[model samples]
Target: MKAFWTLSASGELWQHLAISSWRALVGFAIGGSIGLILGLISGLSRWGERLLDTSIQMLRNVPHLALIPLVILWFGIDETAKIFLVSLGTLFPIYINTWHGDTQY
Candidate 1:
């Protein structure tokens, strides 16, 4: 497309792409770190599982879209909010997988 080519040639597209990549990477790191930590804790220890698994499972059941309004209210439509949403979106899956992997071994 001519428009796409124009934007790419101007560097605007790359800039936006880089920003998006950064956000995704940062969010994934934060979410993955927390998820892995919590998963390990829960998977390895009875007390940790008792304390966190039920709450995490319950929270996981709620839809991400349903939390958008609340997230906007809490975070106020900023980069932080965007990253938080991404991290929150990523957390449960990473946690569930990590926990399962840890427990299965």
Candidate 2:
């Protein structure tokens, strides 16, 4: 499994991790914003909640990780693809947390 990816630069592991972290941070910001907007809507408005709540729940329930292959195919194993996947992973948690917080208020 590990052999699939090549770590070409022997001492570039730190740099690689840094790049991955930067991508994840970018993804987090984008995904978190979308999630917050969604969570706020779901928590604050009945119409908005009804419109998104089900779909969000449904999609979130699906193994988001399952989309990686499609993502890689669509975006090609680039920074965009990595960020997109990370963003997708970040979305639900932020949405869920915000929704919970909103409801608790």
Candidate 3:
């Protein structure tokens, strides 16, 4: 307990937290932007729905973890891999919710 509290007060812990928070924010922003754009396109226009909706739905059904091996192979063990993984994981929920919101009204 003492060690943990000391570490939490240390600069290293703060730095690690800052880096993680930044990564999460960036990943979410990228995922949300893509999802919002796609949802808007599909929900607002007939042509866009025809062109993008089926594909989006299909991709949404895919488990994000299933892509981990490919992502690791392609991106290696880098920060980009972490961000990309997070973005991919977040994309489907945002996309689905945005699509539902846009279409419901």
Q: What residue runs in model 1 are displaced by over 4 Å at the alpha carbon? A: none
Please say which candidate is ahead in TM-score: 1 or 2.
Answer: 1
Q: Candidate 3 has which clashing residue pairs, if any?
A: none
How high is the CA lDDT of each candidate model? 0.93, 0.87, 0.86
Residue-level lDDT tens digits of model 3 in 1-105: 886688787857788889999999999999888988888888888899899999988888888789889889999998999999888878778888887888898
Q: Write the per-residue lDDT of candidate 2 for residues 1-105, one digit (tens) a residue.
A: 343244544556677788978998999999999999999999888898889999999989878678878887899988898888788888999999998898887
Model 1 clash tally, residue pairs? 0
At residue 74, candidate 2 shows an lDDT of: 95
Model 3 off-target regions past 4 Å? 1-3
lDDT of 1 by residue, 30-92 (tens): 998899999999999889999999999999999999999999999999999999988998899
What's model 3's overall lDDT?
Answer: 0.86
lDDT of model number 2: 0.87
Each model's total of backbone clashes: 0, 0, 0
Arranged by TM-score with the best first, the candidates are: 1, 3, 2
TM-score of candidate 2 against the unseen true structure: 0.82
